[model samples]
Target: MTEPANIPSDALTTDVLIRHRREIVDLKQRIKNRRLQVLGLYGTPIVILAALITWAGLKVFVWLHSNTPDAIDNITGFVVFFSGVTFAVQAVAEFSKELSTRRDRKTPVRELKLELSLAEERHVLEARRRTPPPMDRQASYKERLPGEIARLRKESRHYRRIHLFMQWMLFINSAAISAVTAWYDPPQPAKGVLICLGFIVTLITAAAGYFKPRERAFNLQLTADSIEQNATALELGISPYDAVEEKRNLALFATTVEDLRAEQRMREQQLDQPQQGQQGQQEVI
Candidate 1:
């Protein structure tokens, strides 16, 4: 899209950036929804199979302990027959419908992703071209602080959510393994499955430890809070920002904010670094 001839460069760039960003976001959401739909479509059969397997396992356990195996035989047979029929009917209907209509109804995910990437690139270019020189440091800070704080908090929330999800997965997997081992002697297949789950839990634990999302979240939040506090103190003429001269107060505020940001960047770098690198840095420090 071409910018209007009448519009100023900065305004035009800002408008283009905003529009492209919105388009990118919308494209991403659409891609996510389409992927979810595809996953659900393919996953239904696997879920059905898992349920059948679990039911069969339970029945096997019952059969081993109970004398009336024949009593449940008809029920089992009926359930299996019904499940098979349902699976066949649903699969045929859904697969046929999807195969027939998918291409016509939806944009392909790859195309959407390509579109998103192009939009993002356009956004970056527009952003680069639209850099307006700040009239003053205080004005710049006043304009930037709120957006910076919001961005930091949003990122913090995202990382915190991931950390919480991984933690909960670890907890649930650990509990499942413990309950299986302590309460019941499961069959060989179940034991193998438990082993796989334990391996998954270990991998998740290692990932959580390595990436340290919780620590990242904490650092981001701390930095955001510090920045916000300094901004507030500067506004209210409080301690550290209570200097007589307005320029001095603004300079101090800018320095403090910059220092906090630098510290946050350092912390983020440490988190991203390998343990050996971090240890070496610590030794140097």
Candidate 2:
């Protein structure tokens, strides 16, 4: 009998890797099914809208070619009526989808996802348990903090760019649409469609403001920077970190980082509360 030579103790065993790989494949399939479920849930209104648009469009086309004033006026009326109905229906559908997604956050599907995440974490822990503990685990952990900080910063920048893009879209499109409508003074049917478009854009802008993705990204970046400062101070033997022992310093860093994350979550909840209150009030009305 002989021990296997040249095998890294830290490397994962074939069986463990295969098991985790299967779990990952299963998780991916579950995610795809969840997406299909969402489409099935939210797609009905869109399908209805498409059918109405097709019917209305054909009527308008036929009436335009007929060159009858009465038919044209009828077409205009249909455009206005359908536009309003479409907005109402779309708004309701979107609100329902949002509520459904929020509810689903705590549903069994999401629980299964959380379980999968836990399993992956357990796999990592098992692998670590099998490996001889590194002599400088604390130092290695400290060394990784800068990379984590960079990752968070990059994500924040990405979100900021998206925020800027959305702002530009709202401003530019609103201006362009308004200018074109006023200058051209398009026919009643076209004008109604343009108005509907403007309304849609306004709704999108309002939704973006409510969600405030950019603000969340900024907060995450700030937290990462705070953690990075602490990590750097410890590494450089500066200030408060200078007096703390190695193990205690690592514990303090971890605790502080968790506290920062908790604070960020609290702020997010506070921001969401007003939006939820407004929604509730709207429902009451």
Candidate 3:
């Protein structure tokens, strides 16, 4: 709950400020990447679906115009076509949200990470005492990091539920379009066309629904190992320096670093609680 105060505002005038600016630039770049991801993930598929549905409609239009004798009266047919489009768009919307969740978060997270590295250094220096514990360096994680992951996983699951519902809505709309258009003109060329397009959308939506996103269980073992390693290294009088500054997968590391800081605060609170209690008991005596 305590606000960060160690880094002086004047430090921003130093090289770290330059790095922070670059990070902000990268944050903007990442936002652009997300925009493109959304477009590709949603726009491309929607366009393809539109094209296929249009193809079916065009065939019907050609047939109706060619042999309608006097007039081409097929209002219900086009209604079915647009209904399919609407349904497809809704499904796309759902999928787009799912894609966004997997890609959002950049600015504040980066700064939080920079702060985390500094905290790790200070933590190591403050813990200097014994022998360093062997840690699995590759898979280090913080407890709070897992909580963030869980929150995202929950969001993904909710998005998937909405996606499934949207898919089902499309399926129902497609079926209705096929049935109604066919009833209006059983021998019409558009009947088979609508039915075929309906089946295709149905298949696509079904496939999309079959795959759902999930979260990983937090690795407590990795967390314990990381903490023990830091503590042991401290015991041997090792100065914490460059290890945690690792920008390798900055997003992941930043979130982990924040979690580590949160864990530290909790530990500090626990340590202070007993002291506070002992002081009160002494005063009573």
Candidate 4:
């Protein structure tokens, strides 16, 4: 076979690469905190405003019935009480946050230095630690292809199961909301709980739509099937791979399999992002 050429001279050492990754993790954690803080500052007021609007609309219903103990009266009273409590809690939290920020500023610089030093020590220790070797040998296409197929199939099953569960939740929540609103005329507390359930269902629906877990599963399965076909053809001396010399063809086949796996991995990482929208949804909860 031909020798591969041109190793890059500017490649980073393993320790430097790992340290960079650790720094990235730390940076992301800081950004996540700042984002959540901003969201909370903005969202609490919007939620309170929504509660007020809901309260006002329900008040008209109560007034029309002349303060009778109907569902609308109970619901209006409930919203007023809860909205007041929510506003109070948010106020207190904001006050506490201000105090905490002041305290953080007053903290000693020496303490900050110590914390930084400890973080560095932890990173160094982690970088020095040795990982266990991979269980499977991947020196050849024959060895690697089956492992890739198994891995892809497992991932597909995982995502498919999650997707199915979310689908069931969406259906069940929709049915429950319909039943409570139409048939039973549930009391105030039950109605409030149902509303929260509806919100949760909306959150789950949003998440499922954003992530497209079923689509991911389908893609993974498709890739696995394609790789399996290629592996089978190579094994059986079928066309394409059959035309090439055995050793060279095996190398080419391995490269193709790895490339496919890499593409799948990149897609998986994109799907895995815990960005602002998901974080905002969690705040709603």
Global lDDT scores for all candidate models? 0.80, 0.68, 0.50, 0.68
Please report how far candidate 4 places residue 11 from its true position, in Å: 34
Please identify which of the two predictions, 1 or 3, would achieve the higher TM-score against the true structure.
1
Clash counts per candidate, in order, are 0, 0, 4, 0
Off by over 4 Å in 1: 1-135
Candidate 2 residue runs with Cα over 4 Å from true position: 1-137, 185-193, 269-285
Which residues of candidate 4, in runs, are more than 4 Å off?
Answer: 1-139, 186-189, 272-285
Error of 1 at 254 (Å): 1.2
lDDT tens digits by residue: candidate 3, 67-89 = 53232235434544665675566
Location of the lowest summed lDDT over 10 successive residues in candidate 1: 98-107
For candidate 1, write residues 179-250 as lDDT tens digits: 777766555557876898799899999999999999999999999999999999989999998988888888
Best by TM-score: 1
After superposing candidate 3 on the true structure, give the runs of residues whose Cα lies further than 4 Å from its correct spot.
1-143, 154-158, 209-285
> For residues 205-279, what per-residue lDDT tens digits would candidate 2 score against the true structure?
887788786886778788788888887777787766776576666666666766876877776675577777757
Residue-level lDDT tens digits of model 4 in 1-285: 222322231123345646756775764555455555545555656776776777667667656565645775576557666766766664455566554442223234455455556776666675455321222122333775688789889989998998999999999889888777776555565778688879979999998978888989988998899899888887888865786567666766777787887878766765675677556655876
Query: Deviation in angstroms for 212 in model 1?
Result: 0.6
All candidates: TM-score = 0.54, 0.50, 0.26, 0.46
lDDT of 1: 0.80
Cα deviation of 90 in candidate 1 (Å)?
36
Q: Considering only N, C-alpha and C atoms within 3 Å, which residue pairs clash in candidate 3?
A: 129-235, 130-235, 132-232, 132-233
**64 in model 2: Cα distance from truth in Å?**
31
